[model samples]
Target: MTLLDIKDLSVTFNGTPPSPPVRAVDSVNLRLEAGETLAVVGESGSGKTVTALSLLGLNPPEPVCTTTGSLRLDGTDLRTLGDKEWRSVRGRRVAMVFQDPGTALNPLLTIGTQIADAVRAHERLTREQARQRTIEALEQARMPEPESRLRQYPHELSGGMRQRAAIALAIAARPKLLIADEPTTALDVAVQAEIMAMLRSLCVDLGMGLILITHDLGVVAEQADRVAVMYAGRVVESGPAAHVLKRPRMPYTQALLAATPRLDAAARTRLVSIEGQPPRLRDRAPGCSFAPRCPVAVDDCTAGVPPLAVFDGDHAAACLFADAPVELPAARPASAAASEPGPAPTTDGPSPLVEFDAVDLRYPVRSGALRRVTGHVHAVQGVSLRVEAGRTLALVGESGSGKTSLTKLLLRLERPSGGTVRYDGIDVTRPGPADLRRLQREVQVVFQNPYASLDPRLTVRRILAQPLRVHGLDSDEDVLVGLLRDVGLDSFALDRYPSAFSGGQRQRIAIARALALRPRLIVCDEAVSALDVSIQAQVLNLLADLQAEHGMAYLFITHDLAVVRSVAHRIAVMRHGRILEEGTAEDIYASPAHEYTRELLDRAPGRRDAPVAPRFSAAGDTGLSPTTTPASQHTNKERSPLWRR
Candidate 1:
């Protein structure tokens, strides 16, 4: 049965004077049937979420926004419904699951109360009846101890538990359609798989339609039945998951598949990054929105907008030359790979850039208003690692595995409770006033969440100039332009703010600011975790090129092991504030000696042979390999897995 139908739908948002009104969604058509999952794939600000929100009249109020076109649910047109009429359809017939559960659930209410309230809002149910229904909803969501969890608040639950509770609330009324917007984007790989499985099961058991909005193609491959590729507020491609994923006709879709770092890919394989950012909604380039970045773009591509042309069965693509033969940039001859230089060479007998010697960072667990120390929080314990000059030391672990604490120790954001931290052979554990200034000047950081890290009020030029001025370096226009150019950005970006740039461009700006002082050591804390695959590849390559030119050392921290193989010279696997295994990148990838490390590797998705965990070849074994020493030199004795309660 056709559960939902949308045709020629367009959403427009009003902008201030001097800027044209933005057409956030333009003439998009979609259809969903019962017991089917349709995945909408795109980067940030691509109108995926906006289109999802418009389905149930959840978009922003009028005076600033307008939505037009045909939208029907079960043969009834939703566009003709008034506010009061739509309320009956929402929550009872259609429901939504937001990206972040922490912010979605009310902290003042218990989990059970929220679910019960949702039940009561849509149906005629007493408190006791609602409570009973809530328990059943929680049970169906696959949440354990559903009865006991009823009284617990949002803060008392783990990240995974909170998301499950959110799902329970959404399904409380047994809505016919469910829209999950990046449901597992914030979850670990294992938990993500579990959630995806649960969602698929729910769709089958409930016999409901599902629209999943996400950027992770891996998740789509694992769960989605059909796929829609959106770009600049348009569906560029639509087809079965297998066909679109394996034989993408649109260049944008092909680029996304090529740029993603796969677990099965050989170690140090250079990711094929799409050259430019997506078109801005305000600008909305004429003809094809992807023409500027399309590798096979021709003059005909820019002549007019191409409608979605259907091909074999349900497959369709919005490209003027979808049927024409085209060669991908990455598929060029081996001579192209030979021209690019490898990773920066490390100096023999050189001083370590940053060293942590048996570091232990502990905090007192306070209770009551008197703030008595009841126990200690062991954030980092006996963690020892060496980051040599001009090399990348990747720190890989799950969330709350002390990755951030380790970086904090290196940044001196928190004083270590035990052991020492050395920088350039100087003991920086307890630096004096002048030493602190020197440490700050010599070390810098680029954080995750580029939008949050960058100041919204400051222009790009001022942000890059502030660091130089603070360090008493030249802050001239030439210096600013040089910084921008160093990170593959043009001078035109100098006048823009963070809001004007895409996530990838904002990260490049962040990298430029970090280089303003020419720091010897950089702490990149989950820098590319929130980016799209193509953007992540672009940023990773940019980091590599910059490191080779500047000879700077990097403490690259991330949970993405596939990305680690491409950039890290050494790999350290951490669990519960302790290092389980440490070795050269090649040795660890080929054979991890620790059980915890093996578990992490096994959980990685898209691996060809992952039973004993995927094995990656060392340098010189694949194309675009990063430079590395033989595995025998840096192998360390494996330690027993730490206890986690």
Candidate 2:
């Protein structure tokens, strides 16, 4: 049975005065069957979230926003429901799991209290009954020690635990439908697998329909029964997951697949990037919304909007050239030349740019109102690693595995409790004022969220110029323009604020600023994890090119193993604040020595060896072979003594 059906749904947000109303979600159509999963895939601001919000009637009402067309739930019309009616339908019949559980869940309330409150909202149960039901729900969501978690607040739980709690709250009333928006976006690979498995089990056991809103194609491939590809407020394609992923009819879908980094792909392999950004709501042109960015687009594509025409089975595409043969850019070989020439190498031989020697970082665990130190939280322990000049060493680990703490030690943001952090043979655990200034010039960092890191008030020129000014370098307009050009942006972006740019563009601005000081080592702390697949591809390619030209080393820190496969020459697996395994990327992927490393690789989604349909291939491609290095050539240091125990 069709659990939910949406037809010709158009959601528009009204603007004030001179500004025109924006049609955020335009004439979108989708359907979800009982006990089935429907995945909605799209880049940021592509109406995926807007459409999801509409399902719950969360959009602004009246003159502020307008919603039209059919929205039905189990043969009942949802559009006709009033505010009071929606309250009964929301938690009782349908529920939603937001992306960030930290914000979605009240920080002050205990997990049991929040879930019990939600349970009480839709049902007339006694306080004790609601509490018991909360524990049952947590158990159903597969949260460990469900009863013990009741007293813990949101902050007290780990990221995975928080997400599980969020899921439990959503399912407390056992709704017929569940909506998960980027549910596992921020989680590590192992935790993500567990969450996805738990959600699938819930769908089967509860007979609930699920609508998964996400940008990760890997998750879609693994979890989604059907796929809906959205772009610029419209469904560009929709079909069975296999058909859409393997034989994608829409250019946008194909481009997204192509841009996604594959685990099978070799290190330093260039990714295919979409040329332009999605059109702004106000600047939307007529005809196909993706026509401007579509590589196969012709003059007729812009003549008028293309209808979602069904061809092979239920597979549909809103493109004029859906049936025609289209050429997609392939992943370039590792030998591809950089865009510009860089300065000659200053160092000779296999000199280490950055080194962590038996590093141990510990924070004092305080107790009582007096804040007396009772013990220590060992964040990093006996982790010895080195990054050679121009090499990329990927530090892969789960949250709280001491990855950030290691980076902090390297950047001199925190001094190690034990061991030395050396930069070019100089111990940086404690440096003089002059040495500190020099260290700052040579080291730079790019954080996960560019919007949070960048100052919204400052213009792009000012952001880039501030670093140059601090270093007493040439802060002229020409130098700034050159920095922008290096990152594939024009001079017109200089005067615009960070808010005006997309997530990808804001990161480029951040990179441009990082480049201002001519840093030797760039610490990318989960930089591309927040971006769309296409945008991530662009940024990865940009980073690869910059590294090739400038001969700079990268301390690439992330939990994404597929991305690790695409960029890292060496791999270091961290857990419990120690290096569990370290080797060449090839050696680690081919034959992981440690059990933990194998578990990580196994849990990672979108395995090429899976029985699912093959990845979308480019024309005249014989497949890019992964470049490998002998294990003997790449050093594997001794493990920490704690690992033996």
Candidate 3:
């Protein structure tokens, strides 16, 4: 039964009079059946999110906006519906789980109150009745201690818990359809696996049609039944999830696959990055927007936009040469700069670039009205690590695992409670102002959220030049241009603000700023966690090249094991402010000594050998069914085989 159908859908956002209007979503078609999971995969600005929003009449206000074509739900034309009619259908029939739970949830309200309100709004329920259902909903979402969580505000919960609570609220009234946007973007590998499994299970158990919008192909592979690949506001490819993922026909889709790092793939292999950026919506190139970056482009590809051609049953692609083979590289070229040798291993090193001799970081846990220090939160305890010049040391852990705290020690943002920190054989643990200035000049950081890391008010030129100016160095146009060029950006980006650039481009700008100070060691805190694989590969390659050329060391902190495998020489597995295991990257990957590290490796997506284990419930149950089945046909009795383990 077709639950939702959309055809020839186009959405345009009005720009200033001097600029052309932006067609964010153009000429797209999609169909969803009950219990179907359709993953919409794309980078930022691909219009996947906008398309999802339009289905619920949630697009930004007009005359700044206009949407055309048909959106039918169960044979009812949604476009013809009045505001009151739409409101009736919005939550009771269709519900949406937004990207950021921190923003989606009401910060001021308790979890129970907020969910009760959602239920009350959609159903004729009293406060007590709504509250009862809210508890049930929380339990259904697998939230631990549902009763206690009801009284807690959004800020009191962990990120994963907050998301789960939000999902509970969305599913409270038992909507027939659900749309989740980047549901697991901010979670760790284990948590992400759990969330994906939970969502997949919900779709099966409730028989809900799900439209999942995200850039993480791994999640799509693990959870989706079908896939739609979007690029520059259009669906470039659509097919069975496995078929499209294994043998993508569109050049863009092919590039995305090749760019992603697989856990099964060998370590330190250079990633295949698609050159050039996606076209701006306002530009609206005459030919296929992707032709500008297509690896297999031809003269015909530039003539006109190709209509989607069908092949292999339901599979389709919008490329003139859709039948052409995708020439995915067996491995990145050996001549690639990332493959070059770095300085000797720390064990055989001249003095290490940075060192921590049994460093301990602790925070006083205050409580009550009197604000007494009840106890200490040992953020980092007896952590000893070293990074040789031009080498990379990766710190892998879940949230609250002391990764950030350790970096704070390095940045001098927090002083150690015990032990010592040394740099270049100097015990400048408590550096004076002049020493601190010198230390700051030699150490830099690239944060996860590039926009937040960058000053919003500063232009690209000023952002890059500020570090130079602070260091009493020349801030010439040539210097700024050179910085941009080093990070694979052009001179034209100089005049733009961080808001004007894409997530990938903004990260590059941040990297440029980090490089401006000629830092000896760079601390990357989940730096590429939010990027598309292609952009991530590009940035990793750039970092490798910089390290090779300048003898810079990287203290790489991230939850992504695949990325860590690509860049790090040594690996440290941390948990609860302690290093569970530490060894050469190869050693750790081949054979992890700690059970926790092994579990982390097992949970990493994109692996063919071992399936990710479903998270054990708070009650310590495996939550597995004896059998497995397709999502559409799955019953509560059928769970993924990984769950059985």
lDDT of 3 by residue, 112-152 (tens): 99999888888899888998899998877777789989989
**Deviation in Å, model 3, residue 276 alpha carbon:** 1.7
How far residue 334's Cα lies from its native spot in candidate 2, in Å, is: 2.2
Best by lDDT: 2
lDDT of 1 at 218: 72
What residue pairs are clashing in model 2? Answer: none
Angstrom error of the Cα, residue 463, model 2: value is: 5.3
TM-score quality measure for candidate 2: 0.86
Estimated TM-score per prediction?
A: 0.82, 0.86, 0.86
RMSD (Cα, Å) of model 3? 11.1
Question: All candidates' lDDT scores?
Answer: 0.76, 0.81, 0.78
Q: What's the TM for model 3?
A: 0.86
Error of 1 at 360 (Å): 2.5
Q: List residue ranges in candidate 1 displaced over 4 A.
A: 84-175, 329-349, 368-371, 426-428, 456-462, 474-512, 609-645
Ranking by lDDT: 2, 3, 1
